[model samples]
Target: MPYEGPRVYRRDELTYNRYLKVEELLQLQQPQSDPAHHDEMLFIIIHQAYELWFKQIIHEMESCIRAMMAHKALPAYRRLTRIIKIMQLLVNQIHILETMAPIDFLQFREKLNPASGFQSIQFREVEFLAGLGNEKLMGVFLNWPEYRDTLQRRLDGPTLRSAYYDLMRAYKYRIPEKISREPDEKEREQILDALRELYQHPNHKLPVYFLSEALIEFDEYLVLWRQHHVLVVERVIGGRKGTGGSSGVKYLESTTSKRCFPLLWEARTYLTKEPQWEAEENEVSDL
Candidate 1:
């Protein structure tokens, strides 16, 4: 071991450049122009960064799904916290794209025809895994056989919403079997009634109640990101058609109201307890 006069390091112990492949990553942002538009680099970077974050969000969501399926609340809650944080980034990152004015976008926008953020498979996977599967949306990918096949698999699988009800069932909540596969309005009202009870008497199932609230937070942030996306698109492109052959901002506007976990939000309308707050107010008045 002491034979070497100079110190030596193995390939695994090499520098940051080798470990992270910084050079390779840097090479990925090739501008689609003979002489690139000044803002083209920003455009590519922002979307690329979003795709990278979407990949992480999908990874966390899948892990959460497994935990929920296994009737594990803590693991699922922890993963959902990570997902919420990534969604904050996803919502706020649109501001970076807004910095490039419409005129700047026009310079290289034509070069990006047939390519759109709508085609992001990772984003689609995140939505499908988190319980936003729609056959109409899936149809858009039919021209691309590989993407269509992958999306179809997501549609057939158990969603996080289903797995959530399964988790609640493990905790002895009376969730209907029919609601587990597809959420009907009747089933949703029944679940909302149950959720109101759970939220009102949280001591009965603290972990389950806490997890429900976390899922609601995730849902809220998901809607927020969609809202921000619509605003960003409207600000930059107005009513123009998308590069991907869709009615750009109009399509985005319709998606802002979509809910991943509707019952979680709807149930709050029925939680009318004011005892805790009233007690705090009384104490303040006495003081």
Candidate 2:
């Protein structure tokens, strides 16, 4: 069962070939000041690494939106699927911040020159692409022309929120009657009636399953990502104010409650008349 192999490269020469350029990545950390404090390296590297990851998340989201526009949803769904994995990676990244004690951070925190995640234009653009738009957040990048332009472009264009709604509306109708068969007023009325009853009673079926499950899957991930980010902020930074000038953990925690997909969560209440959401001890118990 044993197989012999080369365990290591024997003084391998650095070929200028087409593999990932190691030197560029290795040299990315350039501290902004001289006599750089020891903790400065740690803080800078951590933030820089995050920006790289943020860029990738943005790239994937743009692809997803584009795919949906082409009416090829599978590609868009595939892109959205990778977001959960990225969120898991991000969760693990919080541990790195945990290693930086307050004393260590204080050594170099004052030298940070007001740079903050609030100024991360790419991050805000990704948020725009995801459909949780806020005009106030857009103002953070107003000083940077390229970034502000990019954010404005995405803001004034089709977003994931509208796409999600379009998908849901398509599902709310039955094919043949609504699509292929051309439903008359009476048929449309019947479709609405059936949906109303199903919403009122659980021992019933929707006109279509594909759309409902898709919407729920999307909504669930949105909720999960928001909650995870809130927890990360709470753990790493605590109650102290954020460098971004917010009220810190409490502020971030309140944001998590602002559901990106509000209607989807509210719609669950209409799923069954006999208490779809029974309030229990500090939790919701759904039946």
Candidate 3:
């Protein structure tokens, strides 16, 4: 096989706007505010930006999952790195939302009732693809047929964690047989024990060790994004119930500690934090 360069054409052949559909994209923001409040445009654009990023994140995650299922660590690592970078962008993006004053948010907040971020289908898909799905969460979308159907597909689908364990098994790691949407303490302990060995004796199993840290970084950034989201919501809406009729900040507060990879996180606690240096070994943290 030969390497191919990007396709090129005459100067008038293809354009930036045509390639990106910029005009169509610009028209998609249809704010319902009758008077067109000043801050509503910002709100719409920010959310639209988020949805675009969410779509890309899903694209990257699906590729990563496929690679993991095929026991391809290098490709999985590449996608995981992209996901981590995108998630960091998401975490920082919350600050833009926080910049809107409560008064400005209230000017257009009423227009958003029943259309909360909770209804973000892609975000829910992200959660499911990342190994965080359950019937209770799926039930939240049951009232809407389209949303429920989408969620139902994810509920019945494969998850990143499941694929990861399969990858570990392919690599000859002694991972536990039991896998669940919500793993029990015993099941978690079994997985954690495997992780402990990987962390302690990482030199020989370099690829598995790389994947483990990638997963941990992914989980860590997810937690950060959720925490940042909670703070942004609290800043904008205070103690008010969510426009979607949920407990708002309180609900978000409760979910901040949710880990998509619980065993990977718990495994960290058992690690000997003291420096273990090998001059020839590159720092996995750099990945």
Which candidate number maximizes lDDT?
3
Candidate 1 wrong stretches, greater than 4 Å? 1-13, 180-182, 274-287
Q: Can you write out model 2's per-residue Cα lDDT over 154-174, one digit (the tens) per residue?
A: 877766655543443444423
Clash number for each model: 0, 1, 0
Candidate 2, poorest ten consecutive residues by summed lDDT: 173-182
Local error of candidate 2 at 106, Å?
1.3
Model 3 residue 236 lDDT? 85
Candidate 1 global CA lDDT score: 0.83
Per-residue lDDT of 1-287 in model 1, one digit per residue for the tens?
66768566677788778889999999999898769889988988898898889888888888898999999988899999998988888889898888889988888889988789888988888888888887778777777889888888888887789889999888877788666445677887778877877776665676787788889889999889999988989889899999989899988888888888877887878888654543443332210
- Candidate 3 regions exceeding 4 Å error are 1-12, 272-287
lDDT of 3 by residue, 7-94 (tens): 7777787888889989999899888898898888889998889999999998998899999999988789899999999989999987
Clashing pairs in 2: 176-181
